[model samples]
Target: MTMPFRLTVLSLAVAATLAGCNRDKADETTPPPAASAGTGAVVTPADAAAPMAFESKTAFAEVSLTLPVAIKAQPDLHARLYAAAVRDLREFSEGAQADRTEAGGDEGLGAYDKSIEITPGAETGKLFSLVRTDSEYTGGAHPNSSFAAILWDKALKREVAAADLFTRTGDLSALDIALCAAINAEKKKRDPQAETVSLTGSDMWKCPRAALVPFVLAQGTRPGKAGGLVFLIGPYLVGPYVEGSYEVTVPQSAFRSLLAPAYADEFAGEPKPEHAGA
Candidate 1:
């Protein structure tokens, strides 16, 4: 069955080392193409300027990673995020290979696939946000997709965890309540029969806590101001996998008081119309 795979941010130095090791392995496994006669430059068949930072194909698996131009513009952010994605892809590829070997090629397994894309989000003041969506199928009954949020601090030139934006690192209860309400609203819209449950409820349909969910900053009509937060809730969190994922948005006014003093002003105005309750 499909399952969630969490992605964590890694240090730039560590990512660089891991990338170097992977490069060495690739060189050993695949030989380079011949160079042009007149220019004396290597001519690779694949487009060198493609957005894909990494790609691999084998009998067991096919993996690829793509980063947006906005992300690539920030060298430090790009290196750390790319490194983490590459590491996950390698782990998945290795595990698939091992499983294939154990099965002895009798199970009629198809080649597993994984694709990760980093899309640019809103840029509010000193904080810029990006969303990473991962889709994979490793011999599962069906494919699974998950999301992660990357908050980059332009002033500090480093990545910021969502928890760091608040005073209390534990849980933002106010934000949690707002998220629950927003999700329930979306549920009712999708399925009129779907019951709206509270966080205190014990049923599987109960709303998930905001602190545990991934979120990206939403862009508003006003320039350099955040519309609000768009919490990314995966399947099975509130409903069955067949229902798919949910993107519930909580407006800035909903939990503005919960934000840390430093980030209070960063969020203002209403979320763009298109992403109001998405």
Candidate 2:
């Protein structure tokens, strides 16, 4: 979490007093450090400057962005990632405003707004996760939001998707079946009120392999030795949006057989025992 930001546009000019508007207010300010060896223009927290902010407000809507401290630690990697996040936010905000304006500017629009918050997650060796959460309110019955947990291979400065963690078996039907049961089991285990539901052959059972890409990852024996891969599924993915978001954690064991050789050791779970017949 960084500093609280405010971006209000439209005729409403949403006053700053709006609830939960100014959340992260920056305190200490720092500057980018001198370039280091191979890091190029990257800077660590110590040398990184304060959050960069962008704001726009009109009678019809508002748009604002507070950049996370750019890393520049690995060439332009940090900056590039941050830029992508910012670009998404900008498009969400500005696009809505444009659409509304074309529709003759809703006479009763209340704070057509959008905001993004970035936070750091698990980091082991050169692998790290950057979690981005977006919350926005157009003229909807409720606010719309989303979360993306990106696992990055910092050493290589690229993103790691779920498929990359496994070997291409040409067919993932088995993996899909196992994950659905696992997700349903976890859900019921955590929720006392949840019914014992069989996800097999159900639409809910279709847990996209992509859904296993972790928002947060850590060491464990379940999903793999690398730990549990927790995929955050928003409303409508598993259930209606009003039902809220859901998390299905596929332990390393769930797909151990499919684990890529490169990732197998990292995601290895408990060792299988030798057969007594042997």
Q: Tell me the TM-score of each prediction against the true structure.
A: 0.79, 0.64
Q: Candidates' lDDT values, in order?
A: 0.79, 0.56
- Candidate 2 runs further than 4 Å off: 1-56, 63-75, 189-216, 219-225, 268-278
**lDDT tens digits, residue span 1-278, model 2:** 22222432331244333323654754222234565647575544433432355566766557666545524343344555556766776677667778877888677767578777766544555566666677778775887878777677766667777667668775556656655665566556566565444434464534445434344554453342345455566665554465576655555565677767765666544322210000
The best candidate in terms of TM-score: 1
lDDT of 1 at 192: 83
CA RMSD, predictions in order:
10.3, 15.3
Residue pairs that clash (backbone atoms under 3 angstroms), model 1? 247-278
User: Candidate 1, TM-score vs. the true structure?
Assistant: 0.79
Global lDDT of model 1: 0.79
Report the number of the highest-lDDT candidate.
1
Cα lDDT of model 1 by residue, 1-278, tens digit: 01112322234445666668897554343335665536766543222323347899988999999888887556667667777889999998998898888978727768989999999888888888899999999765788899999888877777778888777756588888888889888898999898787888987678777878888888876789888998888887889898799988888888787788878888888999977883
